[model samples]
Target chain A: MSIEMTKAEVPGVPLLEVRDLHVEFHTRDGAAKAVNGVSYTVDAGETLAVLGESGSGKSVTAQTIMGILDTPPGKVTGGQVLFRGEDLLTMSEQERRRVRGDKIAMIFQDALSALNPVLSVGYQLGELFRVHRGMSRREARAKAVELMDRVRIPAAKERVNDYPHQFSGGMRQRIMIAMALALEPDVIIADEPTTALDVTVQAQVMDLLAELQRDFHMGLILITHDLGVVADVADKIAVMYAGRIVENAPVHELYKRPAHPYTRGLLDSIPRLDHKGKELYAIKGLPPSLTAIPSGCAFNPRCTQARDVCRSEIPPLLDVTEPDGTPIGGRTSACHFWKETIHG
Target chain B: MGRYVVRRLLQMIPVFIGATFIVFMMMYALPGDPVRALWGERAPDEAQMAALKADLGLDDPILLQYWHYLTGLLQGDFGTQISSRREVIDVIGDALPATIRLTVLAFTITVVVGIGLGLIAGLRAGGKTDGLILFVTLLLISVPVFVIGYLYQTYLGVKWDLIKPTVQDSEDWGQLLLPALVLASLSLAYVARLTRTSIVENRRADYMRTAKAKGLSARRAVTVHLLRNSLIPVVTFLGVDLGNLATGAIVTEGIFNIHGIGNTVFHALNSREGSTVVGIVTFIILVYLVVTLIVDLLYAVLDPRIRYA
Candidate 1:
């Protein structure tokens, strides 16, 4: 279904583009390929939702893009993660670090554990201004309060001195978001930002991200297992299956008609409020082991519509087209019977 | 905090008594008699031996002897050395400052130098500097204290003239430097390694990633985020090391010419001066207790997770 959204024309150049990225780890047992040839692009002011289940290389890919992967267990084996046309993979550690906070920032999951427990919320927030901008303590403190207020923290000025442990989980996540926005980076990668938070707080944080993204026009990469999150905020969605990008398309188009089996499985799995008390659909079988991947398509054994060809040869992401045949994300999916699920 | 201090002080009673009992038993159980040693190799007649035994209350049961010692200690009246006639308190009092001076200086040097070196090494963990520090620390830890003391005296003290040498009997900085260096070397290296491991671990903690994501400099990330948290374990190690450090200083003082408590204890033993020996042991126990208390207090400060309860 090559149905490209007419809205694909992002002004100027794409803010971030990932091409054929592969990340591996050498353990005592053997090498584990965490991310395998994943590719996508995030235009300026766009929100790219990397949709995946647990252990689908979502967090690893995000950490890799953020330049914070544990070196011993994680090595960027092959990849080109281009941020503003600069190859992030090839850059020196120092150069990558410079871009890490200044140009690109990351918001981690588990906000409660992410912020330093000993430090006050104000101190953690003020650190960004102090380090990159070299702001004075008083000035930084003032700006930190402003950021807290901007993120809608109650009693922002008063509670600025409160430590992370003092804040609620939602408040802590808001603080994390505030810190990420402190430096005003060009790109923000929020890896499962709301997983540890309540549904209400998740929606609030997601809404805050949308507002901030619109305000800053920064390329926001939202990595999540929740389809509901991407439905509202994501401009484009990249469905990942066993470390590989199985499908890529605009959010509206993909949600209206998912082109990949994995994407379809994911959409079906969500317990929609509209269909309360209905039997919840779930994707069968566990995610593949990275150490010993399947012979062909990593998701073949789990995919309901997988054919003999799917078990023998990996189906490359071919452009799926509607009757009119418009290109979408310049790509669609890698499935033999994607049309059956999409048009069913 | 006041309640905690009061409670800790109350708890020390049984501990000190237990320690005293052990020291008393060990001293009595030793192979030779203080009377025989004092009287010389030639066996003394009953009159002289009896006199010596009476003077020491050797006629009293071991429990009574311990009770008397404990009471005397409580009253600040530890008896005089049998041979030297020097009061145990006076002897230990004179030596305490020197031992304290050496240990204090050594500890300060260890913390400042060890932690600084460790922080740098940890910040650049797996680098050449880290490997070099790890190698040196392992080497230092492996070598015995006596060997390091004598070696420092022979090389740095005498030959290289990095520090001046003093006469064997002189109570001077020149002689104290070698002993101090020797005494602190292992602890320095150990603490450095501990700090390195701890700081490296903290540097890799999820919170540290948050700090960097907040645009903190690499230096700030290690210093502000990692070091403070890492130092928690180091504080505990220091606390435990206090007892071992005092014991190790005995060898250090003997190797150097410093007339500290260790040297006094050594001479007291050689001369069968039981009171002086007891005095030195009691003083060490006190120092150990004080150091442990300070470290516990520091732990509360360093790791916010710890509480005095």
Candidate 2:
């Protein structure tokens, strides 16, 4: 098999790699290019945080990779989603289905809406084991309780029979996490897992996720627009703007000096204690509408440092480097003047 | 669950009394004395009529008469029918089997055909099948029940001779099939529309997406997750419809000439047989009460969130 050959030939190849993924949504008005040539990688024991504003195609990209895109409206025009040297895009639906929730699992946002309200949490959680592993109902139920306990849900035995409405918001999100973690998947994609939770609970959920990722050593792709929430948990960050990744960097370095104007705008927009009295910075304009993205760089109209080149030509993602031409490891920026933005 | 049932049964006692009392009062309020109406254009001797009235307790006050009737009813003694000189209980016993057969057959057709078509239409919403279902249901709703009955009788019965125009044998399934279809037609339309709306609304729900993402097969996702939630409203509608089907459908019964409760009540009303009408109407009320209670309980079973104390 190609997987065996690739494992032998290419040692330490990324567990999952998304190469040049393009997804579009056809509407009555026009076709909205929701995801435009997104590319990212997730390796074992690594976390890739996809950061973006609304309409940035971060979630859409994840959906495409997971093969859960609503395809009548959304059409995947081009892409190669490589999972362990196999093209998930090219795979049959049956094979892709096997890979989902077994090889790779996903945790959705809005746990209340995501879970089946009629079914018990135990049944929903136990379903994965029953369907994929062919475990007896009793075995699956026992496994479900263990998963609940692992996620720190209080009195797992008692709560296993409880429905989604019975659980608190934090507990519900924990149950969602528990579902994703049940099978010990090689990779997990959590789409805005804490967006629906309180500020205090957000940190708790993130900590739990980080701990689980450590314990499982799974490749994690944490998708969110919150710059601060993913800081401690994410190893690397991909900043997306108007359906494209404008910057990809190791998380801490990007925070210190953002190589893209949009990333800088996002970083500056974060509220700080010292700047409490002063009016907070906000990205001046709204994100570009996907249906009518700018001809050049999609963020050109909103970029404060926009020039004629930025207006007329799309900037390719160039490698970020120092003034002396010493390259920064694992850094790239889609900006005409990356030097000015990062090291100026 | 047990407590809820007991509470509901106790509540039905008042309903039963009220329903029976109203029907009894209406029969008493009719212009002509039922005894006189029973004799058609024939002169009855004044002494004979008075003796018959005294014998039947018609000389007593209406309340006292109703009390006698209620007491007899409690002891499973429906009074004799004046016009036919037959026991009201015997007439009901003859009619109940026919009504049950029609109701059960119609209910099965409504649930199976209505829900089956609805699933087909809803699963393919915005397509040709959905449009066709919409048009058909609209047509069914617009046309009155009597018009459909006559048309089916004229076309399917008289002209084509596919089946008998009327029920020849009240207890026979073969003869009752056409009548049941006519009875079920309107309710089938409603169930289909209700089911389609629910399925369309829930087909793309977030939980459904979760089911798919969880790697659930298409069959399991629709049956276990989508259908379970969608059927809650449809089942509630079907519950009331089933009760209505069992006791109602007087129009269908008349066209088909089946000796069901509705027809029996109709014939009794025309002949001014007070005992027969009051007796059957009371029985219909009891059936409705028990059925609605069953529906309420079934709601809890279908949706765990709905708990009855």
Candidate 3:
């Protein structure tokens, strides 16, 4: 309880806030704009699901916020990542490092690759305590067992000595969660945590994550392309296309009526049991290459409702309203024809 | 592990026997008559030659002579040299200390310099230091070992007069230093390239990123997570090189005039001392077998994935 007290020091400031962030990868071809002017905020106990396809910069945004971006090829061209009103980008490397795995922990998508193959599970988990808290080896090991049991790994004592290869996929993910949870981080950015798990195991891991998030009251920014997964856990949904957030809204409102054509296409693309025999629906063209995104809107090429205005003039992200002009709070769409999109 | 070591030891027997037997055959197959060679250009009396051949077991068939040699070896007898008429066992014992000293010093230099350069180059990959290490190692590797040995002998030994032109006493560590370095140079290059490559490859591994994400300092991440995994292949290479250093450095020994196993074998082969050559070659084969066995055992210690059954 004392650990949770520090984050609430500033009442109005969110746990984490990203404002107009831009990231680019310097490829041989050109500087590819991986994340362009992306912004969002997540308070403690909130889950903001950043939804997008593989190259939509969803993971890049999360990585940038965590201060773990690979700097040589990838760079933060502009904007700030604020944790409790302190800009992470402006902080020194040593200061940022102190924040990592302590204030802002992360869980990677692939547990097998993320966890060191040679080290035992206990050692990896205990490392957090040893490094950040300066705990003794025996104390850290006991904390590791406590953490493993907290994640519900059966017989934590017996399995703690096992290597990463010894565990099943689900168990490995549980260990990953255990590691992320080890230091009781204030905010955890889980990048597609269940994308590699079995279908049945996906729900178990997601449920475990949700339960833990609730238990710890930590801010979670869940990044994934899975619409169904987002619908359940996310309080807010931010749909991204070509490095920009095209739409942001409360989860239920966005699903009830999408204000952006791209979000509509994504919702329609989800395969359903009722439409079993029908030819599946897919969006008209692929997402644009970051290096060569369209002038006005990055999604204009794939948008079915793209117009002459959309091709020439870049649309600012404006708040969405019902056809009768009843604006929904926090519902903004970056589209030239948001009115048409919502009405239709 | 104990059982595995015992099993591995037992497996070396056939390898040892096959190696020694081949050397025995090659010695007998050499194009000269051993007793006649021992007498030089002068002809001995026919009866005296016959008596000497009988005493030496040279008149017996090849298989019978091999059987006699094997029995004597099993009874801890390496037999007497037909050339010097000296005890073969005593000669090998005298040469061993020098070879061990030279090889051990050489191995130490190879490890320290090779691994240190590799770590620096790998950590600063694509930097100026990395390019310099790559250039130097490439230069070392392409030149032949004998050429390297001679160059060091001529320049550092004779021209500069920094050390003796040839080793005055093999037991004097300072005298053996230059020769040891020449022996170590090629293998040092190989180890550096291997360690650098391993370090570069493992540096990009996902676990290394995880280590950084764990709030570990860059030094801790590299030393604990990266170095341990990267050094496995380099250690294996080092093991094989250790075996080679002790026995296969005949050229270096010749250049330095060091009375080690290489020098002993070179003189024995030249004088057509069949028994002496066979005895010394057999001892070298044993050393190689023991070193390689130790290397195999070390593989398990370095990597947890490989468990001996």
- In model 2, the clashing pairs are none
> In model 3, which regions exceed 4 Å deviation?
A1-7
lDDT of 1 by residue, A1-344 (tens): 11112224345646788889999988777998889999888877889999898878988888888878888879988979977666778777766766777788989898877888777888888877777788999999999999999999999989998888778899899998988888788889999999998988889989998999999889899999888888899988889988898998888998889888888888888788988988899889899888888978889889888778888898788887874666555557888776676667
- Scored against the native two-chain complex, candidate 2 gets a DockQ of 0.77
Top lDDT prediction, candidate number: 2
Q: Per-residue lDDT of B1-309 in model 3, one digit per residue for the tens?
A: 999989989998898789888999998888877787767889867888889999888989998998899889989899998877889998989988888999999999999999999999999999999999999999999998889888988998889999897998888999999999999999899999999999999998888877888889898898888988899999889988987886656888998889888898898888878788888888877877788888888887777678788
Per-candidate total of colliding backbone pairs: 9, 0, 0
lDDT of 2 by residue, B114-197 (tens): 999899899999999999998998898899888899999999999999999988887789898888998898899999999999
List candidate 2 segments past 4 Å from native.
Answer: A1-12, B59-68
Docking class of 2: medium
B142-221 in candidate 1: lDDT tens per residue? 99888887787788878998875543634465556566777889998989999998987888789987876665667777
For residue A33, give model 2's deviation from the true position in Å: 1.1
- Model 1 has an lDDT value of 0.82
- Residue-by-residue lDDT tens digits, candidate 3, A273-344: 999999899998888888888899888888778889889998889999878888789999999889989987
Candidate 3, CAPRI quality class derived from DockQ? medium
Share of native interface contacts recovered by each model = 0.48, 0.65, 0.56
